[model samples]
Target: MEEEKILAIDYLATTPVTAKDKRLKARRDPWMSRVLRYTLEGWPTTVDNELLPYWRRHEELSVREVCVLWCDRVIIPRVERPAIIAELHFGHPGMTKMKAVARSYLWWPGMDKNLEGTVRACERCQQRVKAPPRALLHPQLLPKRLWSRIHVDYAGSFMGRMFLVTVDAFSKWLDVYATQSATTEVTSEKRKTSFAIHGIPERLVSDNGTCFTSSEFRTFCESQGIIHTKSTPYHPSSNRLAERAVQTFKDGSRKLETRSLNETLQTFC
Candidate 1:
């Protein structure tokens, strides 16, 4: 049943009763018929002004059976032009690709502009257009003092507990704290504990996770006189220091089997 429905849709899309097909059929009217007949009957010395160009370009032209004219292809009628463009763009290719495909088997004046217009107006193509290329990375300035700038991130729900990890940008010192949950309060508490040990950082960088972006986290940073900066969403390279520390901790934890979380943390430190 599904296959039959799909076939029926295909048939409808390609049916000859469409507006383009009807206009193509209408090309058999007097003026076009006469032009086709003249092309077939051989070039006239004094041709219709409209047809003089075709005759002059006759070396590039061909005539099909049933008196249809071809110039690299069956000369598409004006009303059927959009239909041909639509067919070539069925794959929703960009303007250049569509124009290349059309040129392979078709020719018409202003066809390039028409293909571009069709592609631009295509909803699917517009919706699926790729994002602009990312800008090159601009590295942050190095911290002059140890623990002045810290990159912080969370790692794990390993063994049902989460660990907050911080890495000092200058000294590369790492601090890890296990927490019951990754909520803003728990994360802030863990960060406070680390600040007490290393002294408060002048700047803190982190990914745009909920715990980092929460109002409570902002308030905590404000109270501590810490400048909070977030990396671009979904981009871990911008937070590479913290990410590296998290990976290191995870690797160490995985190596110690049958050890409690505190034991693993101690081993990692």
Candidate 2:
């Protein structure tokens, strides 16, 4: 009997793995693993157990290979099987439906319990969809006088393009100048010309982008009798007015599907 069992195992081992072999495929499937683990103990083991014979036959297959075969043959064939599984006498339908969705994607062997744990951990489903954005700590009251506090910044360049932005705090008046480069040499010259046309403002707020923080920009501000201030790192709201104006221009430009920032700035102005 033992020699016969060994011969059977050897014969099964020589068989090529294929989808047509359901008995071979089930041994590798995680869902089937769970089912077998729960119920196989109740069945008497023969001289050569069914699982041992199958494993001997497919000893060359890796776990991942087994999973792929199982998915392709078993899981994909019954695409909505989890939903039907949900119908098989269980808990809340809502809970069951979620499990159904999760199982549809996450149902590899050993994942059934982990998927349930993940479903339990979702806070969004536990509560409402959204909470109102926290109240703004600093409401932006527009400066009462034009040019009393100005915001200036550079946008777009380093790939050989540039646009300079200046906005009057009160009127929200915006001026955009296209520059050939973002270097101090080009930016300082452009600032001089812009301020010459619009007159120097009391304060300039900007981010710490290299174009704004350059030594040339500081010297230009000093020469123009303008006070230069910078926003906190990554915190654009420190230069709120100028920041909002820039966003408005970019968003409108994108919505209009235009190539020219000049045209977008013109619309905003």
Candidate 3:
């Protein structure tokens, strides 16, 4: 039985590790190490109050190369979360960009709220994240496949920079970039990163902003064999999914704004 358990451990340690992984292994996190042990030895039928969160995700929890993974994302150790947050927030990415980066490969309880706290603590972000008032709109069309139809828009001069936000019509996956300019050229360059990863969408939707309506942008879309579309100019109820998505992004990031830190800790505690 011990040999079989050892074999299972070795088999489960196949995921590749990075400097981050090395650091994680060295830390010997009490909670994460316990979770790793449970994954190998099997979880108890019931858990302590502290282990309840991990228990809820026990079915998806996995051990990967000495790291605990929730799905494909690494379960960040509490001690390491601050560093991860700093790395992801290095570019001073806005709420959308921050969440996009965080959701890519990291997970911890209250991660989203913590990210929001980091942003709210920033005097600079509070100063520059002014966006247009959201307008009510009808439902936007959903696509059959990811990257088939995407709604794109600008969020703000957030953090003293322009943000280009694109929402996948199917997955609703958000792509955000912080740029010094919102020019058509810059927008095209930013979209290239997303397009490279997800492939160019067959249909691209955006409001009739100059960045989208400009002849240069039209040419760029044509070159990529993309079908460029514009939302109705003034009618709020027409087509505005991109704006709605941006609104959702902004709203979700700030939902915890009113809570005090001590209160936040008490709830989690």
lDDT of 1: 0.69
Per-residue CA lDDT of model 2 for 1-269, tens digit only, reads: 33322322232213233334534655655445433443333323432343443233232322232232222122321233343333321221224554554354333333355445544554532332243433342435556677777787766652245667777877778877777766777777877787788777888888777877888779888988888889995764477666666654444444444335554445445
Question: Largest lDDT belongs to which candidate?
Answer: 3
User: What's the true lDDT of residue 93 in model 1?
Assistant: 46
Rank the candidate models, highest lDDT first.
3, 1, 2
Which model is ahead, 2 or 3, in terms of TM-score?
3
RMSD of each: 20.7, 22.0, 10.6
Ranking by TM-score: 3, 1, 2
lDDT of 3 by residue, 155-206 (tens): 7654455667788877777776667888999999988887998898999988
Q: Where does candidate 3 clash, by residue pair?
A: none
User: Relative to the true structure, how large is the alpha-carbon lDDT of every model?
Assistant: 0.69, 0.52, 0.70
In the range 66-95, model 1's lDDT, one tens digit per residue, is 323344444544555667776666545457
Q: How many residue pairs clash in each candidate at the backbone level? A: 0, 2, 0
TM-score of 1: 0.46
User: Against the hidden reference, what TM-scores do the models get?
Assistant: 0.46, 0.43, 0.48
